[model samples]
Target: MADDTEANRERGIFIMIYLDYAAHTPVCDEVLKSFEEAARDFTGNPNSPHTPGVMAKKRLEEATENIAKILSAKKEEIIYTSGASESNNLAIKGIAKSYQRYGKHIITSFLEHASVTGPVAALKNEGYEVDFVNINKDGSVDLEHLKELLRDDTILVSIACVDSEIGAIQPIDKIYELVKTKPHCFFHVDATQAVGKIPVSFQNMDLMTLSGHKIYGITGIGVLLKKEQIMLEPLIHGGLSTTSFRSGTPALALCVSLESALAYTTGHLEEFYDKVREKNLLLRRALEKNKNIVINTPEDGSPFILNLSLKGVNTNALQAALDEKGICVATKSACCAVNTVSKPVYAMTKDKKLSLATLRISLSHMTTAEEIERFLDVFLEAIKG
Candidate 1:
């Protein structure tokens, strides 16, 4: 794929129109500038006690404060990590170990990303009882099922705020209300697909996960927002750092870029939402006309992602066909194993064949009408028998 893309660039004809924004976003110039500026200006370890070190620590603190202010959390509540995957792990595993004496039960749904599911699976192998909350036909968490699943022994309920593959928005507020009834239970939300695209409040969560690349910031930086009262077993326990929950040298540049990207995204969320809605609508109108295509994303799902399945058609072949036309998308989550059915789609549609043939076309505020039209043209051609 890399070689083909490079060859295409060398030929200097078609520039790829990317529609995989759910998996990753291109770092914007402004965010990249912030990263470069931070690297140059803060040339000392935040943990160091000297003059340059103090300056670096101050800058990183300011960045944390900025992000906390956006999340409606205190500065001390934010713990930086490698990315959302680590945050998910820390939340699931850390909470499992820290509070296991109270209870050893965990609840999650099939709609979660690989990162969330991976940790939960690991816990199950370690003698912790794990339960999966049923998802509704729309792919959102089934509240009644979740209610039945929660128990006094349920120490944690981890769920994604939004389904990555099909974009189903979970009712976080209601879920919080349910989780809080259990005194020992902690609610962890993977908001990696939610924060920059829509409005979310950390006030209702015990632990929350989000990453930079999803919002056009530099990759490899993310945060785990922990309520100040919670105690987490440290994921990385080697050195002194911002929070004892994870210990590592801060990626100061990545932190700065994350703050910049988040600030810009939250500030213009409405505008971004409206723009992506129109693009999603365009894709929906065009694709729904094709008898071979079945839209998997619910009507009320996030407008940034539009998932559809090609009936009786091999999605991998379709993806390759679109690639030939210089367009980019995903068969599922970018990290998902290739040639496998989309779990989220199957949860929503309950159709194995449709799930097997699913394709994800994620949009962004940067996506233009021209790109959508071109993609539809190529897509229609590819699906032609």
Candidate 2:
């Protein structure tokens, strides 16, 4: 019976109409090609001193330089990591560790990804005080409340440039203006959901995190851009890799793929945005026509992510029904989806029903209008069932 089931599963090819770009994107073909070439040709350890090693080191430097150019940041500011989660942890913990003597108070928004919230929570357990800013119904941070929370002993103010759950783009520029005026406060942004999807500059940020997988690059690769003057303790110790901030055998292929992905986005941003916006509008219209649906994501947010709530339908059951029909979407952040409840979304919305019924549908440049229509058709049917 098991063998029969296995053979049946093998015979059925699941065509995933993925709508979860906010969680992670399928690696782009151009990025995969670049990565494959690097993996096959640049296998030498970057830390070695021999000729192959020298070449590998040069390749890594070139990749870093390319990514930095696209981000408008210095090459030295970009530190490679496994992904944005690690980058967020390193940024928060490293800063907390390095500057603990200066202050013990930290501030962050409740809507931040668990990657940020987890680190802040850990720091709080270790005697550091943390203040969590509340978000408005549209999922925007309350800037006045944040300002009130800021104090002389506040050492860090961390926030997400884009809320992964509701896709609301925070006022990072406004927050930056407010925080930069404080000489002692450092600003960190988890830009995993913002980079590549929208315009981003490092000018106002003390530190920022980016995930390769979120931008159609290979997984297990991310970037942390830190201001040159900012002090951060090393997360890992050993031979020099990423200015000794993170130490490991660098994934050269992943880095090369990330650089290629960035290049691709830089060249096609306008075209990509236009197409995604059109598809998003189409999807929004389709969902809006369904009186059972309530749009949760902000209307003005990133065109790539759409969050919705369906009345009288369980989100998990709806997701399962959609999966059975060969459509792919998510109930929440992939990292936290397995949990029975959405902790992050609840922190922002404070409505259990909104959090439980919420489904995130994200788009990529490759997503088509046909796919959106098919998904809506399937979704409407599923809700009826």
Judged by whole-model lDDT over C-alpha atoms, candidate 2 comes out at 0.85
Candidate 1 lands at a TM-score of: 0.97
Q: Estimate each model's TM-score.
A: 0.97, 0.94
Off by over 4 Å in 2: 1-10, 337-348
- Per-residue lDDT of model 1, residues 1-385, tens digit only: 2336657777775588899999999998989999999999889999999999999999999999999998889999999998999999999999999999999999998889999999899999999999988888877888998999999999999999987899999999999999999989999999999998999999889999999999998789999999999999988899888888888898888999999999989999999999999999999998888888999888889999999999988989888877776789999998899888899888777888999999999999999999998888778877887
